[model samples]
Target chain A: MSRFLSVLLHGFWKDLPPFRLVLGLCPALAVTASANNGLGMGMSVTFVLIFSNLVISLLRNVIPNKVRIASYIVIIATLVVIVEMILQAYFFGLSQQLGIYIPLIVVNCIILGRAEAFASRNTPFLSAVDGLSIGLGFTMSLTVVGSIREMLGAGTWFGMSLASAEFEPFAFMIKAPGAFICLGLLLGLMNAFSHWRGENVIQK
Target chain B: MDLVLLAISAIFVNNILLAQYLGNCPFCGVSKKLSTSLGMGAAVIFVATLASIFTWLVYYYLLEPLGLKYMQTLVFILIIASLVQFVEIFLKKFSKPLYNALGIYLPLITTNCAVMGIALLNIKHEFGFWEMVVFSISSAAGFTLAIILFASIRERLFISHVPSFMKGTAIALVTAGIMSLSFMGFSGMVN
Candidate 1:
């Protein structure tokens, strides 16, 4: 039980997908223009990650060692297609917002990284927990980054205007460059905080 | 003229790395040194173009006729993985020096989103064979250009006084942001 618990919590902070592990950054940067988009993208990734981890863990024994990577890609791609269809059916606006990123999730690295590292070696139940934890961690990071960008850029939080009408949005905060700079500075700040607390920062 | 504009736009305005955010792992991971970045760039130029061509062919000749368009993500990835394997073996047999140059980077290209992203974009934009060829080469060229410039900047950063916490990827990412900002200036040149 403790092992499961530890596995679950690690992804939250210790191995936070985008910040700590530094995996799945392409989606982290691309679809985070608005808080809604971030949440949508994060949820989609979470769904895919959970199922892919579960399936990969279950098949770990059966899949040939030589072709495990290819098998994993096939599984991840199928899950992404399912998610893409669901989003198109129910969340058309967001699907449009995310654009190619939805399909690009196949190469996000986080899914593949987890499948290769944790899932392949762990029990199915434990792997599922790992998936949930890591997926949520990724979701949390995207949401935080998205909230920051959306609030600063559009003076809104999840589409709710938080800033006064007089506030002029810093339009640059929502652009391509802003994604890099914002995530960079946030990462640096996290490192500084980790250092002050005497925890060894995960150097990516 | 339109083809030239497409090339410029793909290379500059829609840079696969800076603007589109594809293939960022190598953008950050393999960009620390000039020599390795050059090698990776060349490998990408070679493989991405080939992958694009083959994927385009497979899409038009096989998937579209069979109405397997939904399988694009899966098919494209499998094609790229196998294609990378074939290229690796082909290079090892034919050109020892070329293989030596791109040996390490070839395997990594299978997972690089830029290769897959370019394949998907070629289809999305509905480019014909000639247009796909132009777009693929220029897009890879754009990737090469960005990484080379980034490597030069990162080399300089090694000597600069970066704060301790921001020493590695953090600082590199911040620099990439500035570079991306500069690249945004080209957006006006197209569209």
Candidate 2:
């Protein structure tokens, strides 16, 4: 049970995807311009991560050694399509909001990174736990960045218009450059917190 | 005239790294050194051009004809994976100097989304064959340009004193943000 819990917690702070490992930068930056977008993108990645981790864990033995990476890509791509279609079918508006990042998720190093690193080696149950933890961590990072971007850029938190009429929104916060800057600052803050906790010090 | 504009626009206006944000893994990872950046840029240009052209054929001839267009993500990734694998072997065997230059990065481009992104955009925009080739090449040129410029800045950064927490990827990203802001200047230069 402790092992399972560790696998789950591992993704949250220690092995966090965007902030710690910096694995999934593309979507971490792209869809994270708004709080709503951040949550939606994170959830979609979580869904794909859980299922792909499970399937890859199950097929670990049967897949040929040489072709494993290829096999993994195919499996991941198929799952991304399913998630894309489902999102399109039910959440039409979000499908538009997220846009190409959905299909682009297929190439997200985080998904493939986990499949190769954790899922390929561990048991199915453990793999699922790992996937959930990492997905949550990723989701948290995206939301934090998105929320900050939204609040500063648009004077809204999840589109609520929190700021008064006199408040001047920093419009650049939602632009492409703003995404990079917001994420960079947030990442630095996370690192400092971790450092205060006496964890690993960030080098280049 | 429009072709020239499209080429210029893709390279600078919608530049792959700063503007579109694809292939950033390599952008951030390899841009620490100008040499590696040049090598990666060259390799990506080669693979992205060929992969886009080949994937175009596959998409139009194979996938769309059979109504398997939904399988594009899967198919294009598979194609890119194989394409990079083939290029790795071909470069290693034929050109020793070139192989060493692109040694590590060749395999990395397989998963780089920029190559696949360009292929998808080609189909998405429905470029003609010539237009497609030109777009692929120029987009890659754009990628190369961004990465090389980043590498030079990162070289200076290596000597500068950065905040500890913001050291590494954090500072790199912040630097890229500033660069991206600069690139936004080109937004209306063409259209």
Candidate 3:
């Protein structure tokens, strides 16, 4: 039970997708212009991650070692297709907002990384929990980044205008450079915080 | 004339790495040194162009005609994975020196979103064959340019003093952010 709990909680901070592990950065950087977009993208990825991890864990014993990576890719790609169709059907506006990044989730390293590292070695239930925790962690990070960007860039949080009408938005926060710098600074802050707590910093 | 503009736009205005946020894993992971970044850039240019062409053909000739457009993400990924493997084997057999330079980066290309993203973008933009070729090549060139420039800067950063917490990826990302800001200046050059 402790092992399961540790696996579930680790993704929140210790192995957080974007900040700590530094995986799946493409989608993390893109589709984060607005808080809503970030949440939407994160949810899509969580769905794919949870199912892929569960399926991969269940089939870990059966899949040939030689072709495990390819098999994993196939499973991940199929789930991404399902996500794409579902998003298109119900979340048309958000699907358009996410654009290519949605499909690009197939190549997102976080899903593949977890499948190869955790799911393949663990049991089905544990792997599913890992996926949920990691996926939610990823979602949380994206949402935070998105919220910061959206608030500063548009003077709103998740499309809600929280700032006064006289407040002028910092447009750069929504641009390409803003995404990089924002994430970079946030990463630095996380590391600093961890360092203060006497934890080993994320090296790379 | 329009082809030239498209090429310029892809390379500078809409850089695959700096602007579009594709292939960042390699951009951050393999960009520690100048030599390796150059090798990665070359590998990306080569594989991305081939993948784009193949994916373009597969989409237009196979998926579109069969009305299986929804299978795009799945099919494109498989094609890219196999193509990278084939390229690795073919390089090893035919051109030893070429293989040595780019061999390590080939496997990584399978998961590089930049290659797959360009392939998807080619279809999304509805580009003809020649247009897709030009766009892919230029986009890869753009990726190469960004990484090479970034590596050069990062080499200097090694000797410089950085805060302990921001010594590695954090600093690298901040540098990339500034570089991306500079790249944004070229956005006005095309379109």
True contacts kept of each: 0.68, 0.74, 0.86
Clashing pairs in 3: none
**Pairs clashing within candidate 1:** none
Docking class of 1: medium
Interface RMSD of 2: 1.0
User: For model 2, what is the error of residue B166's alpha carbon versus the real structure, in angstroms, after optimal superposition?
Assistant: 1.2
Per lDDT, the best of the predicted structures is 3
| Winner on lDDT (2 vs 3) | 3
The models' CA-based lDDT, in order, is 0.93, 0.90, 0.95
Off by over 4 Å in 3: none
Report the alpha-carbon TM-score of model 1 versus the true structure: 0.98
Ranking by TM-score: 3, 1, 2
Instruction: Identify the CAPRI category of the predicted complex in candidate 3.
Output: high
lDDT of 3 by residue, B1-191 (tens): 49999999999999999999999999999999999999999999999999999999999999999999999999999999999999999999999999999999998999999999999999999999999999999999999999999999999999999999998989999999999999999988998
For candidate 2, the chain B TM-score comes to 0.96
How displaced is residue A155 in candidate 1, in Å?
Answer: 1.3
Candidate 2 C-alpha error for residue A166, in Å: 1.3
What DockQ do the predictions score, one after another? Answer: 0.78, 0.79, 0.89
